[model samples]
Target: MKGIVFLGERRLALVEVNDPTPGDGEVVVEIKASGMCGSDLHPYRALQDLSRPPESRVIGGHEPSGIVAAVGRGVPRHVALVGDRVMVHHYHGCTVCRHCRTGWPQLCEPITRTTYSANAHGAHAPYMKVSADTLVPLHDSLSFEAGAAIACGTGTAWGGLERLQPRGDETIAVFGQGPVGLSATLLASTRGSRVIAIDLDDDRLAMARQFGADETINAREANVAEVLRELTGGQGVEMVVETSGSPQAAAAGLQAIAVWGKVCMVGIGGKVTVDTQAMLDRQITVMTSYTMSTVAQKSCADFVVSRNLDLDRLFTHRWRLDQAEDAYRVFDAQVSGKGAFIF
Candidate 1:
């Protein structure tokens, strides 16, 4: 088998390795779709010290959806079976921990964890091995690519929206038209919120429009806070979801939120300065959401199915495993919609 390995400094290699066999309570999945997330760029572009090689060479992708190919001892039929379609939760932790038992293994209390694509092998190849607990059923109604997106990017958007709780009559300002932010526009619109999609790129903002944004604002041309304030009749939007991770955008979101408005920060980035006095005077409530839990991943899929959402529209590019280099080259530009590897 050949797996993609990031060699740091924006370089990657496809190295040959032996096929995996599941161990006790584990299963091996035949990869059908693996998504390319913005977060992947962190490690991809990180500068490495040549003197100190990485401790381990982990696979490169985290958003995985596939069919069960094999199951090991102690894995029950009720848990998984060969040929079952599934999306991976992507994190493994001690099963006894409260967080793990409740579907948030990433927050395992014991601190014992394995995050696919980071510490353990992931789904960048034809096969991936993982605990049966990480499998979240992918509905037959949704495409494998959709399942892959739900496994991470889309699920993260759902988690952020769950935290934002935008109302039907209110307005939501989503700052970023990337995959996650674009997913939020789609989901929040279905919930009846008037969505104001924000981005520096016109193409992505156009994608957001197709995803159901009520309006689009190119931050490059205008003041985000001013535009949002004018859009809401000087009161500002009712809610904000910041997915760009830009310090300027984060600060602008805080400036553009209505009094008592809730803000959910989803993008991972550098520090941003906040106005403590302004927050206090406006009674603003700000929160942050990481990726979704396993249960929430399932719920996200259910929502997509129930809504009959055109999640497939999110993909602007797709590639075979062998096209890993070309795929990342295009995705690294960061101006396009979602990209994935389809097996």
Candidate 2:
């Protein structure tokens, strides 16, 4: 088998590797779709080498969806059967932990936690082996690519929106129009909130408009705080979801937020200093959301199925596993909607 490996410094390659086999309590999934997430850029653009320390040399993809190819010993048919379509949660931890039992293995207390594409083998290849517990059934109505999106990027956006709890009569300003941010815009708009999408790129702003952003702001052309205030009739939006991970955007969100409004930070990036006095005076709430839990992942899938959201439209590019290098080369530009490796 061959898998994509990150060599760091904006370089990657498809390298040959041993074929995966299910171990005890694990299952091997024949990869159908593997999503490329923005977080992948962190390791891709970093100076540090991710291809070292043997274990860290794992395949590069965390958002995985596929069919069960094989199941290990003691794996019951009820847990997973060959040919069952599934979406992987991508994290494994000691099942005894409170977090793990609650379906948040990413927050497991044990050091034995395994994160696919980070410390364990992932679905960047033809086959990926994961703990059976991480499997979430993919609804028959949804495509594998949709399941892949719900596995991570879309799920992360859903998690953030769940935190913000935007209402139909309120307004929300979503910072950044990347995949996660775009998902937030789509979900928030469907929830009836007047959405104001902010991004540095007009292309993404246009994409946001298609996703139902009531208004768009080009951060580079206009002062985001000023535009947001003006758009909201000088009061500012009731909710802000910052997905750019830009300190400047975060600061601007705070500056332009309405008093008592809520802010949810979804992007993963640099630190942003908050004005404690301002927050205290405004009595607003600020919180950060990670990816969704296994239960939430299922709920997101259900929501997508119910809403008939054209999540497959989120993909602007799709390639075979062998095109990993070129696929990422284009994705790294950060201008495209989303990319995936379709098996």
Best by lDDT: 1
TM-score each candidate.
0.98, 0.97
Worst 10 residues of 1 by lDDT: 48-57
Indicate the TM-score of model 2: 0.97
Q: Rate the local accuracy (lDDT) of all candidates.
A: 0.92, 0.91
Residue 203 alpha-carbon offset, candidate 2, angstroms:
1.2
lDDT of 1 at 292: 92
lDDT of 1 by residue, 1-343 (tens): 9888887788787888789999999999999999999998887888965764333488889999999999999998999999999999999999898998899899999989899998889888899999999999999999999999999999999999888776677899999999999999999999999999999999999999999999999999999999999999999999999998889899999999999999999998747888899999999999999899988999999999999998999999999888988888888888999999888
Which prediction has the highest TM-score against the true structure? 1
**Clash number for every model?**
0, 0
lDDT for 155 in candidate 1 is 98
Stretches of candidate 1 off by over 4 Å are 51-56
- Regions more than 4 Å wrong, model 2: 48-56
